[model samples]
Target: MIAKAYLWYGVYIILNVLTIAGSDPSGGAGIQADLKTFSALGVYGATAITALTAQNTQGVTALYPVADYIVAAQLDAVFRDLRIDAVKIGMLANVENVLAVSSVIERYKPAHVVLDTVICSSNGYLLLEPCALAALRDRLLPLASIITPNLHEASVLLGEPVAADEVQMIYQGDALRALGAQAVLIKGGHLLGNCSPDWLIEKSGHTRISSVRLKVIGTHGTGCTLSAAIAALRPQNRDWTNAVNNAKIYINQALLQSTRLSVGLGTGPLHHFHAWW
Candidate 1:
C-alpha cells in the first residue's frame, strides 16, 4: 500500500511511485498531469522525463526528445533510492527511450506498472514516433500490468478503425490482451452519448467502468489524468477493479467540475483539484 507504511522511513514500504513520461509545460498533460494525480491521491511521486514539449491548451508546437542515456540515468537514479510501489508511463518520444525504459523496468520490476499507450495528441501532433510503435508493442506490452489506450489508440495498435460499439471494443480489447498485456483498458470516451464506458479486460473476464459523459467544451488531459489516477490509486486499493473504479470516480468529478478552471483557449484541462477548491 502507498504511504501506509514503508519498511524504512522515506524509502521502501513508503508510497513512492515514479512516472516516466514527457514534460508538458502546458500543465495539462504529460508529467505535469501525472504528478498532480499522484499528489491529489496522496502518493509520493518521482519522475524520469522522456521529452520536453511546447504545448498549450490548444495543441503541441515543438518537441525535443531527451537523450536515451539521460532517460536511463533518471530511471536508475530514482530506482536506486526509492522503493517504487508503482510506475505510470506516458509518452515515450522515440524508439531508443522505449528500449531504455523497458530494459530498466524489466530489471527493477516494480509491483504495479500502468502503461498509458499514447500515440498521438488530440490536436494531431504525433507524440510517439511511428517507428517506435513496434518497440512499444514488442517490449513494453508484455511488461505492463495494465495498458490504457483510448479507442483510437486501440485501433492504431490493432491496425483497425476506432471501435464503433461495445462489441467491437470488447473484441479489440481481447485482441490487445492476447498480444501480451496482462490487462487492457479500452477507453470508450469516443463512443459518445451520456455513458462514457471503458472496458477492463483481464484473462479471467472483463468488466465495464463508466462515468457520466458531461457536455464539456474542453478536455485536454483526460487520458493522461485517468491513467495517472490509476497508477496513483492502484497501490492503495486491494484489487485492480477497485483501483480503476476509484480512478474513474476521481476523473469523472474532475471533468464535471472542469468549468471552474479557466486555463486555455481550445480544450481546458480537467479540474484536478476539484475536491479541494
Candidate 2:
C-alpha cells in the first residue's frame, strides 16, 4: 500500500491528484475545471482524458469520447510515475469508459477517490450516456471513497424526485450509501432557498454543511470545483469531515467571488483562482 502520509525531508510534500475525466474546451468545466481547482489549491495535478467535449457556458455542441483502452493507458502511465494522492472522476461518457476507470482504480487503489457523478450538464446536455448509468452504478460507485452527486443526479440514481428539504436530503444521502458507496455528499445547490446546504454521510457520521446561497452568474464548474477541493484537501486534513468542511468554505468563497469573472455568454464559471486573483 502507498504511504498514508508523505514526508520528504521531514516536510510533507505537495499532494498529487489525478483527474480521470473529460476535456471541456470551454475551460469552465470537466478536466479543465478540475486542473484549475487542483492548481488553485496547491495540489500537483495529472490527467487522463476520457473524452473531449465541445461546450461552453451556454451549452454543449458536441462530445467525442476517447477509446477506453487509451484512457486506461493514460491512467497506467500516471500510476507508474506519480504517487497519486487522490483522484477526482467526472464524465465517463459510456459503459466502456466506466469499466475502464473502475479497472484502474481496482489495480492502483488510490487512497482517495472523489467521484463527481456528473450525469448531465446544467444546460440540459447529457454528459454520461444513458446506457452507462447502470455500469456506473454497479461498477464505479462501489469503488469511490465518496460520491458527490448533486440533487438531480441523486434523484436520477435513486429513481426518485429531488430532495426538497434537509430531511429528504439526508434520506437520499443514506439511500445512496446503501448503494455501495463508502460515503455520499448530496449537494442542494438547486434547492429553492437563501442557504445552500450539502449533506455529507460517512461511516464515522454525517454533517449538514450549509452556506449562504451566493447568487452569481458564473455558476458553472461548481461541482468540479467542490469535489476537486475535497480531493485536494483530503490528503492534508485529519479526516473526511475536516476536509469537507474546509472544502465548503473554499467553494463559498469561490461563489462569493464568481461575479469577478465574465467569461461566457451564459452561466460562466466559479472563480477557481479566487484565492490567488
For each candidate in the order shown, give its overall lDDT on alpha carbons. Answer: 0.90, 0.88
The CA lDDT at 38 in model 1 is 84
TM-score of 1: 0.95
The ten-residue window of minimal lDDT in model 2 covers: 1-10
TM-score of 2: 0.95
Weakest 10 consecutive residues of candidate 1 by summed lDDT: 1-10
**Each prediction's TM-score versus the true structure:** 0.95, 0.95
Give the poorly placed runs of model 1, Cα more than 4 Å off: 1-14
Give the Cα error of residue 103 in candidate 1, in Å: 0.3
Predicted model with the maximum lDDT: 1
Estimate the lDDT of model 1.
0.90
